[model samples]
Target: FAKFANVNDATSHWPTGEEVFTHLPGTHAHAPLIYVALMTFILIISSVTMVLAVEAGHRMDKKAVIKWMAWTVVGGLIFLGSQVWEWSTFIAGYDGDISTWADNGTLSHSPYGGQWVMGVDAHGHEVKQMVTYGPTLYANFFFFITGFHGFHVFTGVLFNFLVLRNVIRGVYHKRGHYEMVEKVGLYWHFVDLVWVFVFTFFYLV
Candidate 1:
């Protein structure tokens, strides 16, 4: 849907001369990209910690499992916090008008409204062009996709927390195996892998 929105004709959905579907506000300062990179780094590190925890579980090393699981939880938390910040920045826009409207819930006006550009025509005549920033569909897709993935991450974190609790209580130890840790680790790794695709399609493209 996002790809379709981006490539579809803008005459019916957006104003004329809209070259893109989403005009991320912080492109000049590279702020959005930096935040994305940071979040990706955090998730990658969390994946490593999960792997370590699983390895420790294989060896029945309770202390090592606790240590790595704790680190994984920390990493998940930081990634979530960073995602919140990024969402806030995206919604508010660099100018803050979108944030104001978002709070008011009034859609009569929007920051995506196009601006007039004065330039020379092909015939060297001065002409004024109405250049649209983008459409609101971008925001819709952004929130829906990222929020869906965020929920998955949240669930992964919750599951990890539960498994960690069980580990602390020696439940896995009593079972003579740590298969639960490995299971949760698989889920964590899947979540992290999904984020890589999301980041690539949403930001890199």
Candidate 2:
């Protein structure tokens, strides 16, 4: 394995790679596969339900459209809830988890108050061993990017609920347009798209 004294020396973080670097360290973290898998399924199913909603709208099946949208909204909300729980768990972790919540790192690896410990995995090492100071700047970056994604998920939950409320009131059905579903579908798909990058960066590469 090669080591870079500074992040700029790393190829993955380099400007030429900046296109993929858009998400940065977030794509590198040890993601929870179960969460990622479940989220993927939810997003795929949501898309399918959305398609059905549009078809039902075309057929003028107001009740059927409402039912499908309701399900989509439910899936989105559930995903959001799971994200919140994940964040909470990450923030509250102590033992092996990086305690970046305070930026003080007192909970895990705050060697110099603001400075966190950085560690490299030794031969045969399986866990993320920390340095006296944190897992280098990469871990910090990983947390920040994933935190942003989780925040997006959190906000998406609210948006999903709003659309669900409108659907329940038969707003889209009355308007004879399912653009609301389309809009939400766009956003949901975007989230899924982002996750695909996250999974590859964090879990695979």
Best by TM-score: 1
Q: Single out the weakest 10-residue window by summed lDDT for candidate 1.
A: 122-131
Model 2 lDDT tens row, 49-167: 87787677678777887788778777767766655665554443323334322221222433234434433432222122223112345545556667777677666667767876887
Best by lDDT: 1
Whole-model lDDT for model 1 versus the true structure? Answer: 0.69
TM-score of each: 0.71, 0.60
Q: Residue 45 of candidate 1: its Cα lDDT?
A: 97
Q: TM-score for model 2?
A: 0.60
**Backbone Cα, N, C clashes tallied per candidate:** 0, 10
What is the lDDT of every predicted structure here?
A: 0.69, 0.55
Model 1 segments beyond 4 Å from truth?
1-32, 95-135
